[model samples]
Target: MLWNKKEKNKPKNISLKLYSFNEEIIFNGLLTNFPIKEELILEKTIEHFEDYDPCFFHRSVVSRWMYFEIEEYLNKIDEENKSEIKWQELPENIKKILLSDKVINRVIVEKI
Candidate 1:
């Protein structure tokens, strides 16, 4: 696939907000409790990211454009492994999010 000159020059602005209340508290209190401000915020952001898994917005859009065959792709991965596969065997976060009605309808059913 090749992009035309206009497509190549398109601007992009993507934001991923994955922070918890506890992380916000820790970040806000850094100036009063810790000497290191920027360093502490960086460390806290890393820690917060560990808790929340991030799926890129661009990837989601691209996947939808392909007819939302994500399940087929996942099944292929499981089949290639040649092991028993179940929803419980998948990542906890994936299992939880995939089972949700909103995600299912919007990203899966609607696209397919």
Candidate 2:
């Protein structure tokens, strides 16, 4: 059987495990690619979490507050210009909340 263009372009799924601050499994699913490095894994996990549900961080008080703060900040920005906001341009406190250990612990990526 020959592979078609759609098959060739299809994204591969990699096993991923996202842990909470206490090492609890927050997310377990397949990702497009496995991120090898520890930091990369964490970033990927956070990205997945955001894609799955941006409000998942609301479970914690500090995280909840930070999440709303980010929402408020984004709301104030012009709708047409909101898309131009980059992660680095966000406030340090908001960034810290997103990257905080209290919100997420670690991520493990397994190639399938």
Candidate 3:
């Protein structure tokens, strides 16, 4: 989904680590929130977490969020079994980002 200019400009002051079920995509950032609507598939995830409090990054605005799309083909890894490996398999940078003491642990696992 194309992010709006206003949303892109927002500052996500908090740090976080995001990984897909198969560790296919890894996202690290200080995101304020996720988009409310994206191809309708994410509608529910957004609504479920809508009332969720925003972290130090700021209030959960439409902007200030970031995402990373992971393609299993790019990594040449098996996507069938993602939970087999431990968190250590993630990139060092992502690991460090998640290790930050101030990070907010607010993640919802959704099977798409």
What are the candidates' C-alpha RMSDs? 16.2, 15.5, 14.0
Candidate 3 residues 13-92, lDDT tens each? 33334555444445454333332223222332355455344433332232222222222211223334332334555454
lDDT tens digits by residue: candidate 1, 26-92: 1222111212233333433445454233345533333232222223334444446532234444555
Q: Give the range where candidate 3 is weakest over 10 consecutive residues by summed lDDT.
A: 66-75
Q: Name the better of 1 and 3 by TM-score.
A: 3
Worst lDDT 10-window in candidate 1: 103-112
* Residue 36 error, candidate 1, Å: 41
lDDT of 2 at 45: 46
- Assess candidate 1 and give its lDDT: 0.30
Cα misplacement distance, residue 39 of candidate 1 (Å): 32
Clashes of 1: 0
Name the lDDT value of residue 92 in candidate 3.
Answer: 48
Best-performing candidate as measured by TM-score: 2
The parts of candidate 3 lying over 4 Å away from their true place are 1-66, 69-78, 102-112
Over 4 Å off, model 1 = 1-76, 79-84, 101-112
The CA lDDT of each predicted structure is 0.30, 0.43, 0.34
- Cα shift from native, residue 69, model 1 (Å): 10
Candidate 2 lDDT over residue span 1-112, tens digit each: 1112354444334354656656776556654221223453344346555433224342233333343444445444433343234445557754554353335555454435
Q: Which ten residues in a row are the worst by lDDT in model 2?
A: 32-41
